[model samples]
Target chain A: MSAMSDDDRRAWAYLAAVAEPPCAPLIALAARYGAVETARMIKARKLPAGNAAVLTATQARCETDSASTDLETAHRRGARLVTPEDDEWPGWALLALDQASTSVRGGGPLALWVRGPANLGDASAVAVGLVGSRAATSYGTHVAGRLASGLADQGASVVSGGAYGIDGAAHRGALATGGRTMAVLACGIDRDYPSGHARLLEEIGDHGLVVSEYPPGTTAAKHRFLTRNRLVAALSAALVVVEAGRRSGAANTAAWARNLGRPLGAVPGPITSAMSVGCHQMIADGQAALVIDAPSVLALVEASGHDNFVRSPATPIDGLPPDQFEVIEALPAHGGLRVEEIAFSAGKPVAAVLTALAVLEVKGLVDGSSGVWRLAESW
Target chain B: MSAMSDDDRRAWAYLAAVAEPPCAPLIALAARYGAVETARMIKARKLPAGNAAVLTATQARCETDSASTDLETAHRRGARLVTPEDDEWPGWALLALDQASTSVRGGGPLALWVRGPANLGDASAVAVGLVGSRAATSYGTHVAGRLASGLADQGASVVSGGAYGIDGAAHRGALATGGRTMAVLACGIDRDYPSGHARLLEEIGDHGLVVSEYPPGTTAAKHRFLTRNRLVAALSAALVVVEAGRRSGAANTAAWARNLGRPLGAVPGPITSAMSVGCHQMIADGQAALVIDAPSVLALVEASGHDNFVRSPATPIDGLPPDQFEVIEALPAHGGLRVEEIAFSAGKPVAAVLTALAVLEVKGLVDGSSGVWRLAESW
Candidate 1:
């Protein structure tokens, strides 16, 4: 496809800055008439036949024209405007947003300001969004990192917000594996809202992508992050929540994923951990499937018709002789038990218990050390 | 309803010990002809016409009749044989087992050896089974204890196996709350399979019930535990697994619950914990709902038409102004954040953040001890 015309690009940039997203009326107007024509109508203060909703949506910022300056600032920061007219735009990924209900506050972005060499449309074809709470636990970060690395190793790109905690860990995990990742920001592409992650965002921009719908110099706010979440969900084939508190922003993203009909998976954590409350709630509400590892996340993506993946099913205990299996089951989950204790627990004679333990040890199902027998860690 | 006659009780006891249990053909024969007639036919080595399966199932134990001595021993031990003719036989609870497919090895027990003040049918009218691995983690036990205590507090009987770890914790929790708890054993009612829980079983017998399908001298075996699991599912309105390894016996009980059309629930734990693998698998496979507390378990029981329970929905971060809500969200899950850090994270001024924190603290939403602000633990 031909590159977006200069007039269309400038018009899109202007429209993006004029309204607070997601302005359903403005988005609808732009779709009916081309971005360039819509911008001309708005600038001339012309009322297009009985469309009063657009006037109310755009009146405040209609006279403002920072398109030239915004484009210049983006170019200086190594970012460029990508409209639906551009071949690199992720139109397929964002189609769901255009069709979603207004109650969900879902509306496609006018254009994306992207900073990276990777093409957004190509990267999104096999992408998964890993999102969760900024106030996350160590367990959450560990799982997020491991899952992101595994997904990247499978040749799938990872998408996430460039925030603290779970999001940062996901970005770092993908980067560590030298795989592609896209960081969609709530603020301007030039600004690092979570300043601590500035360097991480720079690294992502260098190797993958840094995207935002906000214009240059726009600051992050509560409402903007809520708006930005929809894009993260729209840009990925599937979404997995690693961890989240009851009121975490990740929950908003999850709602958006559901609204877009995306396959959603949530990682289960200790019920005692407050940070995992949202994930547990999602699973309990039947809004998400429980996912423990990367293979499970890939399975969700595969369900969306991106690729075929089959996680090797865990092998259940089988084929062990009765006594040997009893001995393995008798050993405590955390520590070793004495031979006499094992015998008592298994309801077998001490000699028989010893024989069974020996067989189990050879099969790598039990460990007998310091005269105490325990189930092998891997078992 | 009339109490079971002596002859019928003796015949049921004899039949219960004649087969290895869950013998579909023998159970069918007993149902077709009365228990007394079925016992007499087996003792005379005479099969009903066209019933070769019954002969193969009962031929080994047909010659031995311990009903007289077994009844005397049970009387001396404060146990009684409650048969289908008895008023307290829990017929409603066992109806599903009789209707289930033979492939599940689900045949109603011929007779129950019960020792307790509580009536079997009445106790099972509103019961929830809390089952899991003998080798469970501290997290699993803690959750199990809390859930059991809460369920008991709500006047629902807690049911579990008389074993160590999660089962012991659940039984003790119910006892501590002065609520009824039933222990269904894999061994004979007179025998203590897990010797460590002998005193716990005695406590349950004193306050609630100890039930078993096996004869007085029978020992616990691997296969017996598998058969015993079905009864646990049948006796309870719902089953909640606390923690289970990949091949824990609790998984078998879960399968039985599903087979019998009983509502099933599973408590979530850290994905890293091997003990929770079976629970996560159950939830992922859609075989069990994700239950976190006693109310959630109660919801499952209520779903089965046993009782009504309503868990208080968690209060999400709402009704707060944007600035205050942002400040609260900025605080980390496990620790506090400094005012300046909160301000930076929330993209608000330091003064605005301080004001929001003050209002939040007054409302008991945030803790501001040691000059750092954190969301209150309860929140």
Candidate 2:
């Protein structure tokens, strides 16, 4: 694994610049000299005479120092770095790079600082990303734990943010059940935030993996947390949100997963629960998939384990039942049909139509206004 | 409304088996010619060999009871014997009658006792049934309470078994919300069991209603409790079980509701919860409609309110996205395809395939298994 030619190292360093562009100037330097000679050209342009200001400014002070620090931390802990050119690189990460090329926010780290022997690049496997609100209900925690254990029981490794509530429960569930789990960190892997979970992290490191984009000594920052959400979404086969607030980090991860074409699954909660609103929204939207059990989740991963991502639905409707067809046909040409007219036209009594209409509303078929049912914009 | 003729009163009583059976039978001397003839020929049946077994039983029991007994208790409490001849009799109760006139295990009550002014005979009205486990989880209690309140908010009279757990929670929720609720007891209405709910029952009696089929002073028996499930199912437009065990009485009420052609609704809980297993099985078997919220329960009621129970799904499935049509058509029937395969089949790029699949899955046009995707069941 240690044997590598200069070309391989050079390609990794080049991809590092493209993959982890700190700013515009750094991107320009990488673009100019193809990484290896960029420092010289940048120095020649910005030297008191010939100093690579763009390349040296970032790599010299940040990349070099960070690498040394990371290496020192890595040496003390026997960890290593894996870049795009590494034999251990997964195609899924490369797919992320391609996606980042089209997006402004970008994909992930140029080099992942890893602390365990996880051949994520190995064919036919799944990484389960379980996330939820920090203030999850006990029910949510229980569901997360069950999903984690079930997925592990099926030989799938669990991946989650190491936060409390659903995240904590998921990791602990895997650990307690003697299963593999990975804790992807926004902060440096060594400096664990929410101090109480250090033991859990240590256990995960022992049997699973803990990898981060940031240098080992870097402190946890809120922005870093969100930025790392893409990695959590990208590295896994599917993202399962056990619980989420209306605007939660779990929801953010789900959105990214959807945008990245990764499968997204969410556990349903009580409709009245404010914490589950995000999940409801995701399921409502054409984004996340809905699963009630771990088998449903595993079924998804196993079916697409060999591929980068699974295909979408292949039908017209979730397959509308007969009554739904009637109500839909009863709607007016432009505006929604009055509930009265719909009932009459569908030949269903008024009460019967009303219930069908509500189901239609949730499914985003007919939008109701002033007691009339019209087709939804989404429909 | 009080313009009932003598014939009408007799007709009502005859339907409820209150005075006499509809069929003419050999009376002691004349024949048992239903309530009509009982009104005209009370003397036809001498004291012995009358078809009024229930009536004779009631009358003789009164003789054994002294002035200081339950009869006095009933009189003091102002409880009235609401024979089916009364204008306030609930027509919904007729649903409990054996279709073939078979000897019902629990036949029509000798007389229904009443203490409330709410008319069960109103055409534009409803009774909502809430039932579940005696040993329910907090989640169950919470859902039952909210569902009951929602029904009451929608102008329904809540009906439930006067049992512990979900039933009590529903009753309390309805009472706290200033809604009409009825506690149907297996024992005499005055008697309270599962003593912890005595205060709750008293409150229901004061604010809503407490009803019993048993004559006053009857103690509750285990068989009677099971026997009581029919009234809970028959008396309402729809029955919603908040949480039920595999063998809970709630399941009995649900089965009866289904068999009676009433819409049956069930609240879903965490799949891991044993309490929710009954609910899950019910939904899966199509025995009970899944109610996600108050609105869904209301929808079920509205759909089931009329004589014809099978209606369009309260929720309609939105059709598939336009762009996904080509993708859907191109999908092989074998199973879910990898993203690239679908994109190639549809003559689209990987990103387009991903986006379309997400939207399609949301529309329920597709179901993506682990890494495999396929047409949804509906499709």
Every candidate's lDDT: 0.84, 0.65
Local accuracy of candidate 1 as per-residue lDDT tens digits, A1-379 = 2567788888999998888777766765675566998899988878566568778778999998999999999999899988776888886777667556356667778788899989988888888999999888999999989889999998888999999999999999999999999999999999986999989999999999999999989999988898899999888788999999988889999888887778889999999999999999999999999999888988888776662111122233443444575577667888899987776655457898889888878878888866788777785
List each model's interface RMSD. 0.5, 3.9
Worst 10 residues of 2 chain B by lDDT: B22-31
> Which 10 consecutive positions of candidate 1 chain B have the poorest summed lDDT?
B307-316
DockQ of every predicted complex: 0.58, 0.13
Mind giving the per-residue lDDT tens digits that candidate 1 earns over B292-376? 9888888877766663111123255543555576678678988889988887666556888999999998888999986788888
lDDT digits (tens) for residues A1-379 of candidate 2: 3565655444443334322332333433343334445444433444222224344445444334234445667657756666544677664533543334346555445566667666645411467789999899988998899889988887777888888899889988887788778888877778775688888777777777777766667678777777778777777778899999888989778877776666888776675678777775675453556677778787656665434543344223323664675577567658767777676555466787899889988887778866767887774
Single out the weakest 10-residue window by summed lDDT for candidate 1 chain A.
A307-316
Q: Tens digits of per-residue lDDT for model 2 on B1-379?
A: 2455646443332322222222212111121233444433333333334346544533423224221344345556655445444666563354243221243443334345454445545411477789999899999998888888877887777889878899998988888788888887887766776678888877877777777666556688877776677667767778888898889888877876775557887776676678988886676455676676667777777655443222233323212333466567557766778887776555456787888889878877788866777878784
TM-score, candidate number 2: 0.60
